[model samples]
Structures are given as structure tokens and as C-alpha cells.
Target: MITDPELDGEWDTAERAEPAEPLAPRERAAAAAARPWLWALGGVVVASAVWAGGLYALGDRLAAPTVAYRATKNLCADFKAQSLSGITGDLRKRPVNKEVSHPAVDAAACVMNNVPDSPGDFYVYVNTELHKKADPATEFDVPSVDDLANVGDLRTEEVPDLGERAVMTSWAGEQGLNLKVLDGGAVFNLRVFATTFSEKGGRPATDSNAVQAAMVQDVRELMAALRK
Candidate 1:
């Protein structure tokens, strides 16, 4: 029953507390210094993860093309050695079209090499003119794998017995030639095809028939080399 206002004022004054000051810049800097490695550790972890992912993707893209090229190169070397074995002539090594060098060839080789007695049957086709002239009617035929049936009498020729599962085909052209080899499993079958056109009678001359015959003969000979 003492005066109510006087009692309330005293109670509030007695319960009041002072507010704390904010941290100073110096204090904050010291705190960060105490755990400096924490920030560096986080940055390193992030960078490492990013680098690893990038490498994985790059490897995948390169794997196929690299294999295809190597297989093609091997084919070229093998063909050059055997085709020009007896003949003493300078065989110019030139890069073939990228289309003929597909990534599938490498992927196929990877699988075929693992199999038992798997002969790498990589295929390549080239079109170049012979050193000598060829009759138009007697020229070779360039047949797509799908058009094997159109090869006519050439298809009936006995496929040379390559000791391993491999065959090579070469076709002659007016300006260039065509060559290919089949090895390993059918899946890894790499085919390299190229064509060159030479002018005859003021026009581009191509003997598809002669090209086909040359391909057959080249393949047959390649098989023989593989046997040795």
C-alpha cells in the first residue's frame, strides 16, 4: 500500500543492465588468423574436385580418336611394308580423310585384343591412279559394304586365307587408289576409303570397275602377308 509509482520506478532501475560493445576490427582479424588453414583447405578441396572432373571428360573424348588413328597408322605401315615388299619404290605416306578414320575402330580394337585369337581386321580404302593407263570398261568398282552384292563376279573370288582374321583390299583409280584392311572382330572393323580423280580427254576419269578389282587383289595379298 506504499505509493505504487514510487515502488515501480525503483524496481525498474534495480533490474536495468548495460549493453555490450561490438567486436573491434583487431579482434576479428585475430580470430581469422587463428584458423587460417580452414579457408585454404576448403579452396583446395573445391579446386581438386573441378580438376578431376575435367580430366575425366577430356580422356573420354580423346580415347576413341586416338585409337582410330593409331590403328589406321598401323594399317598403313603394314600395307606399305607388304605391298611394296618386292617392288623398290618410294611409297608416299599421306594422311587419309578423317571420315574413314572413325572412333569406332579404336573402341573395337580395345575389345578385339582382349578376345582369344582375335585378329584385328581394320579396313581402309584408297583411290589413286595407277602409274599406267587403265581401260575404262575394265576399271574397278567401288562398292560400299552394304552394296557387297553389287560387286558381281568380284565377290565370288575366294577370300584369301589370312592366318589371322584379317583381310585387305586395294582399288586403283585414274588419279589415285583405294585400300582397306579388315582385322580383329567384325565390330572393330575399321575401313579407310579415299578417292582421287584424274583428267582424261579433258574430263575427270574414274574407273570404278578397275578400283574394285585392285581392292580384291590388295586384300588377297594382305591376307597372305598376315599368314607369314
Candidate 2:
């Protein structure tokens, strides 16, 4: 019934529509096969990245303990003297169990036991006296060379207390620093006994390398304070 050419073209739906070509079976199958593998590969990459990141984070936390041990070892090497004569007079006398005159020094002495024990059992002690001369206070005298040499028990093998798997020994030293290590609690099994003398007063010095090491170990601040 349409006479106009424009009207006739509009009325023919088939002329305006284009037919879609069917996808090849091979193409369709290839696309279907690739999708799952692509998703799986992406998942594996993500998992690997997460695992690597966790290890890096763990390593950072362990760094502090490692650094602390190294610092203590260095401190031992630095202040080691051939003879204990410098503080010998003060070391001979017995310690008076009193509150430490220098609390900071006492705290440092306590921390020595927390250091990891290796090679042999480690111990520390502090002895102190109160005097009006010096404000900061003084370290106890070191033992004489002869006395230190004579004392064989300074080594782990010589001391029976160290034989126990979890035995720690600590007492006040000639000055005001004392500490020791025993095998027990996570950290508490280790003990630190610190004494402080007035800069001019305290116990006489002794010649004991074990004692000297104890004093130096406490006051040395190579490592930061440990919580556990």
C-alpha cells in the first residue's frame, strides 16, 4: 500500500537488519580454555607476593635482638683490662646488702643476665657504698692480677653452680654491680644483684676476673633495655 520510496524502505525490517556471523568452534573453545588458567595464574602471583612481604616484616622484628647481642660482645672486648689493680682495694671487702646508690647502674647490672648465654654460663653482681664526695658514685675496685689468676673457678667448668641446666648465680660485687645467669624461666630465671657505694665508700677490691666482667657487663650500655 506504501507508494513513496522512503516509506517503502522504512517498512522493510529485513533490509535494515544485518545478520551476525557464527563464531568458529575452535575460537570459542580456545577462549573458554584460557579464562580459567589466566585467573589461576593471577592468583598464584598474588599469593607469592603476600608470602614475601610477611618474611620481610618478620626479619625487621628480629633485627633488634641480633644487634643487642653484638653490642654486648663489643663492650666486653673494649673495657677488658689485663689486671684488676685499678679497683682491687675495693673488691676484697664483702658487699653490704643495701639499696643501690646508683639505681641506673643497678638497672643496667640486672639487664646483663638477659643476654643470651653461650660458650659458658655468665654471671654478674654489683656492690656499692654511700659517700658524699662524688655525685654519680664510683665503681668497686677490681681484683688484683695475682688474685684473679689464682682463682680457677672463674671459668664455667670450675664452677659447679653452672653445671645445672637452669642454675643462675648472682650477688653484690666489690662495687655496686652484680648479675648472673641460671637456666629456668623465660627471663626471670636470670638474676641481677646490684650494690652501690658512696663514691668514697664500699667493700675492698678483689682479684677476680669473673667479678670484673660482672661489673663491666652491667654498666656497659651498648644495648637498649629488654622487656623480656
Report RMSD (Å) for each prediction in the order shown.
21.2, 20.5
lDDT of 2 by residue, 69-154 (tens): 11111222332322231342222122212233342222211222212333212223332222222222112123334335535433
The Cα error of candidate 1 at residue 207, in Å, is 0.8
Model 2, residue 7: distance off in Å is: 41
Report the backbone clash tally of model 1: 41
Cα lDDT for residue 61, model 1? 44
Worst 10 residues of 2 by lDDT: 182-191
Residue 9 local lDDT, model 2: 65
Candidate 1 lDDT over 1-228, as tens digits, reads 666765677445655577867779999888779786888899899999999989998774444221111233234333442332112112223423322333232211111111123321222333221111222112223454634632442222223543223333333222222333333222112232223334322333434444345445555554443331
Candidate 2 overall lDDT versus native: 0.33
Candidate 1 achieves a global lDDT of 0.36
Global lDDT of each candidate: 0.36, 0.33
